[model samples]
Target: MTTTSAFPAANRPVGQVIVRASHVELYRDGQEVLRDVDLEVAKGEILGIVGPNGGGKTSLLRLILGLDRPSSGEIELFGEPVSRFREWHRVGYIPQHAVAFDPNFPATVRETVLLGRVAPRGVFHWFRPEDFAVARSATELCGLSGLEGRRVGALSGGEKQRVFIAKAIASRPDLLVMDEPTAGVDPESERRFYDLLGRLKDELGLTVIFVSHDLGVVSARVDRVACLNRTLVYEGPPRALHDEALLRTLYGGGTVTIAHSEEEPHTHGH
Candidate 1:
């Protein structure tokens, strides 16, 4: 684990709990989507949730984001029960397929990012100088400085993703949540995207929670991982992915390729 994983597993500094789920269970349409899920994320930690398709990874995220209610159990955001949590300005969410805009959409990068502020400030309210300042900063941070006036529809997939991220961060949320943000991005773009996330974490001290199936990147970038498979299979440091039993339980003997650091990826059936 030490030879492969970059983050040290022991003596990790403890921070405030930003998200917590206890005994969470959800049954939708008579199908059990999640069961007995207990998860917690500390402030400023990058937590990755990984699972097979239809394994309740998104379901859990939806619950955490308060999009869907859990049938039984509790979820809290920033120590407040999710249902009672109303400080939405402190949270930013990028849903799955959030960047699936039509190629001909008329909104420019600046316009789209400005939308993030509309929710925090009333839609009826007019934009202020501070709003433009924040939007510009977010655009620049996302590397979309030169394309502020360019139509988002004309941008490439990776550029579109950055635009969406810029929009998400424009609100200056303390917690940034994303669902498969790298879905349509190319490999190079994915690398840059994670790098941007690292910058956001450092510069803004944001606590990030994202759902992804890209194990290679997840293993390398995240501080902790919660492997979901209709239940919580494993929760610990990225180094825990090396456990064959844990991988088998989470991936169910699927074709698993784990790349450790700059070292080559190793394939194992588990």
Candidate 2:
């Protein structure tokens, strides 16, 4: 398979850099988690990041979201330094396993999604008519319109995931960052979710950055793929990642298979 161009000039404006990282490094407990990493995310692109567990995938995302600071090097969001960037509403994030919300929480689906609008509405302001409209539209877009009144705890794992996605989309963000959004979802549900994501990307012109251990899904769906293990080892089209030698190098050489089927292939390492 030939590698596809990640940044097609016809789809988006030229030289539109949404996220840029230069020589970024991070340390935790005196141990290096990321080393001299450099990355760029163009507008309207789906960038899939894959690597083994503890390979600093989440760490890199944290730096981008301003959740954590890099020990050295520079990072920028929308051309502004991350530390000074204040336009958080332009970015939406869904953490791994949708862990930000408690499964047993008593909030309804609509109410939970309404939380997303709070950022734009300010810290303590009440939800206005427009806020409710946006939340409802987002819920409908995520196929959760009928379930809006249901308690979040009563929903299944897949439904819960959709609720979170609706919450993210309610913000109307330009960049969407997801950390293992399909972690605990069933196979069928996961497939449906990815399909929805593809549609959403096209309809919203979203720039997505996602981290996943599922190589098959990453290869099939993303415009570009980056293999990170402390440092970036590969960064290009998914077709370029089919090499067995490269797979072994990324996963530490036990066994790796890239499935081209409709479903994601099973892999041993994270």
Candidate 3:
């Protein structure tokens, strides 16, 4: 595939670099999972990080979220170094697994989303009226308005995913990070989920950084794609990822195939 500019000129300057990793290297159990990785996430863009299993995708996310420190190099969030950054509320994170609620858990949909406010509201403080209003607004935004009172445990997998997304956006975060968000959803649900993300980016001016293995979804939805396999193999627009040799290098020479779409000329790596 031919390389095109990663972002249009108009969208490029919506905000400063929200996340930056410079020469980052990570090691676990004497094994180097990531080496000399450098990445940047600007405002108002959906960046998809794609790679095979054990490609340090989740490790990179953990470092960005401050859950783990890199073995070397540096990271910055919102122009502030990671070590000194204290504005955790500006970020919203949705982990790989769904919220594990018991079948009889009494939390309602609104209540579940309200948990996101705890960080800003203080753990020991009581919820204020604005907190409830924010949670309700997020619930409605995620298409769960009618289900505000429904038990979270009784919802479908797709609905559960929305609930988590609502929770992440409840704080009106500037950046939203998701790991394998569509892992358990059906194809239709996945499509709708990506559509929702696009809407969120336009309406909320939110910057999204997500880790996904689904090449079709990445190609169709994300603004930029980064292929990682111990290192960043390719970092550019999704359409630029048309080289079969590059795909083989990223996927470790697996039997790769490209599926094309009829409606639009796009490639899906497999």
Candidate 4:
């Protein structure tokens, strides 16, 4: 493990427990973004959070990252309160949108991925040799080796997505939260990305929480699904969520269609 000598006092959790959010309520400017949200993810589980556009999926993720505080309730990571998790290295995140960087910026894929190790400004700007090894491993896992020297802007939508994924996995975080990771990718890329996720979960024992608007893909990929609409509507195995009536209740009514010969897939905000 790469030593973060800078934060020597940082508290590192022991054992396999990863993330737990309890009775979380998030309010923005007096309007509630999330209400009474309770969630938990153990190591090696790929959990999916799905809902309509304003359903607070992103808000839930932010709360887990400690980027935002819940108006009420508590969040715990590795048995410690989120407020006490000084080692931000244990968590990795991929936001819904691509990073806002100059298209012509001269940054190689490896260099960009190494940036993830840059701690708070006061810490050392240097990345240790182990950091490079981690980054290289992530790149190879994402099949981005040959493109390491390529400029960030020169990649396709799927390629750029892989770059971001590589960056997230570079540090070998115990938990990864990805929001709308396949938004712009083609079907083939999307399928491949999920396969990659499954492999990571199995090999690395990573607890993944991924949110997407596509129910078909999410249902096929994740071990379990949670329907969220400012609050958790359901939490159970994907097989139980195949009900058309349940889909209508969760998505505010839509023409339920069975994609890939599976039971009806939910659609919302159409």
Ranking by lDDT: 2, 1, 3, 4
Model 4 lDDT vs. the true structure?
A: 0.76
The Cα local distance difference test for each model comes to: 0.84, 0.85, 0.83, 0.76
After aligning candidate 1 to the native by TM-score, how far in Å is the CA of 63 from where it should be?
0.7
**Prediction 3 TM-score vs. true:** 0.89
- Model 1 C-alpha RMSD vs. true structure (Å) is 4.3
User: In candidate 2, what residue range of length 10 has the lowest lDDT sum?
Assistant: 1-10
After best superposition, candidate 3 residue 10: deviation in angstroms?
Answer: 16
In order of appearance, the predictions have TM-scores of 0.91, 0.92, 0.89, 0.87
Off by over 4 Å in 4: 1-16, 99-102, 120-122, 261-270
Off by over 4 Å in 3: 1-15, 99-104, 260-270
Q: Residues 1-112, candidate 3: write the lDDT tens digits.
A: 2212232212232457999899999999999999888788899989999888889999999999999999999999999988899999999999998744465878889889
CA error at residue 203 for candidate 3, angstroms = 0.8
Off by over 4 Å in 1: 1-13, 261-270
Give candidate 2 regions above 4 Å deviation.
Answer: 1-14, 99-101
Question: Considering summed lDDT, which 10 consecutive residues are worst modelled in model 4?
Answer: 1-10
Per residue, candidate 1 scores C-alpha lDDT tens digits across 202-221 of 99999999999877778888
